[model samples]
Target: MDDSELQAIRKARMAELQKQQGGASGGAQAGGSAGNASNDQQQSVEDLLIRLVRSGQIQKKVSEQELISLLEQLSQQESKANKTKIVDNSTICELTFPTSVLKVKMNRKRLLVILEEQIYIYSLKNMELLHVLPVRSNPRGVCGVCQSPLHPFLAYPGNNPGEVIIFNTDSLEPVTVISAHKSDLAIVSFNPPAGKGSKDDRLLLATASEKGTLIRVFDAVTAQRLYEFRRGSMPTTIFSINFEPTTNKYLIVSSATETVHMFKLGEPAKARLRPSNSETEAPAASANKYFTSVLKMLEPQRDYTCLRIPTNGNTGDTSSGNGKTKNLGSANHINREFKSAAAFCKDMVVVVTSEGYLYQFKFRSPEFKDGELVQQYSLKSM
Candidate 1:
């Protein structure tokens, strides 16, 4: 080859090498950011995200081994500033009572509490019982009275006709028996946010039974049935049902299958009225259209091995319009985002295994799109 042709080929090879080095350096920085997402300021995250622009794909073309190499590169760029690690082999909590605790939640103040035979409302601040309330449930974890974000009163499915016995927290008595469903209801919930209902009277919930694979919604105060959606033909044991409190229009329900379904609460009310001037909503909605969910900060679905939604607020409609069923992001995607860490939830998404172990995650997500998953921790760890 002539001198000119050889010189051109050398220049092309040099450019390709430069491109590879840049990619390597970029990957290292991204790995570091993920390793220490919690530490990086908002400004740094913005810069990193710009560099690692991803090509959205239905399936992963990158292999795990190759991905790991890239991830290591990214990790190198990050400071690894949070070098302090907890070495305790023991868990954060020791099992005191051997009760097979099925339900556990935190209050608005982020107090870690568990509800088994009775309500254990303990204060996380000083590790003291703030107050104890009496609760009643059947073998399959069915009780009308439960702690939910929407309603102060706890309601669980009764033994008959999808019935629910509502209990007043202050009185600690079954004040009402509402036939919330036709079948034996497994759980009850509000439509999500408090007071988002028909005439502000209905509460939404889910009913699971060995009899069929279906979920039904009901009006808690009015005893009126709303809608019944056929979950599937499989043994309709609904494991988890979560209603977003602020939107009051989404339900994240997990069934016997490995997948979780997210349905948006549709605006079914056909009236126009002024919103109440509540501290959080009235002024905010009136001024701007940026109302966030109270439960948005809590983890959605982390421990798939065992997970449960604090069943309350079923007044709204869960209509991820068009009846589309899309698989939520994979576990790795969830871990990448939640790796940084967010605030804690006192009582929100919870689960309990057969070994009498209780699992909890404070569900938190920046966006409120249905089916978008945000896990608190790795399922493998639990």
Candidate 2:
């Protein structure tokens, strides 16, 4: 179209929008919004302060002390809110399977599985059957399978001929298709730290591929890529990206190498994105450090065990040693830790090993200081 024609089209659209704003209180398809835009409320005081700093609105000489004070007050408020945050390790439900190699899908209501390319949705209320949907592809290299934390979509990151298909739970259909950057898939884990407190944040799915370690964060609702977190020296494998239980950050991904990594979903604790100074530099800003020595290691004797059972009690000699089955034997039967899935579900971590055994345990962290994952829990016998 010509310039005059384009201008006329824009004018007509603007007039229509004005008419809608003047008359309507709520549009049928507009989610939480009206045409008038009166609901676009003022920003919070803390948010305003951030905007001022970000937009360079805060004058350089308008008393640095005063701006510092305002920022400190905002920090205090945020800390108070985060202090009340509870660690959600509550056991929701469990799913039993005959075969050890099974995929899992879960929400507040039920657990779904894809075994032998047949989808089985299980009810969480009674642990009964729901329905089954048959998959077309031959189940070959399917490793990581779980529902997205943000939406009602299921993801399986594996050797699907270089592309991973995202399926929906309610309809049992392929909703959106995503892939590794020009290669076969490896491991995929949803970033758990997003969408806190009923917020609709896009689900961040990190995928490993044969090419390298690629991070693909996507909108769970639309199934579109948002940001990509890239790393140096290519990860050993995609399965290397593991997550840890933390309110601060969602992922604790590591390679086969000695170093482990931590990532944040929001504004980092001590980082700000600087304006681009060079073309060669990356766009997004990040604050990550390397683990530097013997301090990187955990105390093997005291930690790494699921739980410490009290073998020697106050009155051990009085009780009969034969009748009461010893707890120490069960605890020490396996010196090695469970080689389960890098990611875990509620109250239970599914660990897999070279030997065929699916072990379940409550992954609890009594503490996390510096960089150690001091997890302790009781083992569940099948």
Candidate 3:
């Protein structure tokens, strides 16, 4: 070969070596972030390093067995920053992103991170990046995932307003796209998995819009409409919407108003449906009879149970025996960004407010008329 050609080959070889070193260094930094990685994270790191070597992104001078031994040493090494070597079991691993995190949701097998325009799904076991899903410009981080391990599904806003994509995380495919509302979506939620014997159990999804008067539920797999619920006649911001985690029979809607509404689902509500009594059956029977009439209905279904959070008490001036602060302030003095969320835990209704108060109410009777506040906890103290 001519002297000029030899020089060119040497330069090319030097560039290739530099590229490989850069790739290896990046992988090492990712591994170092998981200082106290769980066994799963360590295994994932080993798998990644092996793949890099096999793909020529990492040099093959070192055998795979030697690389694995080095990984073991790194995993066992204590962080120099913590001389005491104290381990925090609370956090399993850490994930970094370029953009700010708008929302995060997790299930048994998956962890979802929602950013401004993309959603990232990671495996819960090993914290491996499973998918990067492109979504509409969702500044509010509107997204939901089914908690059921057997049938995992994710829902997010699609390209168009009011459109939602139902994605099957296990199959790594889009199941269906639903035109939930005409306006932009304010909330997207999925009912808890049925955990039934049959794997084909229907996955139900709920959605609300910027005009948060109406809430709709759909069969995610089939794109079939299941239920339509009315929050109120007036338009207000919907704060949070969640299904009863256990039974999936009751749906709770919280909004800007002080009142929280709970509605009974009709069809496809069979997951762990609590045994019906006279009081419960009365409402369902009346709803069925009313809808069966020959006359068409103008409004959607009304709330089955309504719980109004008191906004008129003393504004943090007084303290109860348990030293918990009283009502934050009058309705007019409430924070403009105040948000409220409600969930069902066994028979009690748990309500949490952004003002740092949590109230647990239990129904006085089967009628479920504004249950008495059985317990109160100051979230700020915690």
lDDT of 1 at 322: 45
Q: Tens digit of lDDT per residue, candidate 3, span 1-382?
A: 4546644643454354333322111110111112232233345555665675587643354345434533432232222121111114454345666565565566666666677776776665555666677666887777887877766888888766898877777666665667788999988888876535534356789899999999898887766567788888788877777776555777877776666778887544223233334565687676666555412332367777666565633222222211122454446524465566676655666666655555555633374433455555553443
Model 2 misplaced stretches (Cα beyond 4 Å): 1-100, 125-150, 157-160, 193-200, 210-212, 231-235, 240-249, 266-369, 372-382
TM-score of every prediction relative to native: 0.41, 0.41, 0.63
lDDT of 2 by residue, 96-137 (tens): 333332333355454555454445554445544555544334
Quality of model 3 by C-alpha lDDT: 0.60
How high is the CA lDDT of each candidate model? 0.37, 0.37, 0.60
Point out the worst 10-residue segment of candidate 3 by lDDT.
23-32
Deviation (Å) of 10 in candidate 2 = 29
Clashes of each: 45, 4, 0
Displacement of residue 82 (Cα, Å) in model 1 is: 38
Q: Least lDDT summed over 10 consecutive residues: which range in candidate 1?
A: 24-33
| Reference-based TM-score, model 1 | 0.41
Runs with alpha carbons beyond 4 Å of true place in candidate 1: 1-101, 104-137, 144-151, 159-161, 195-203, 267-321, 324-382
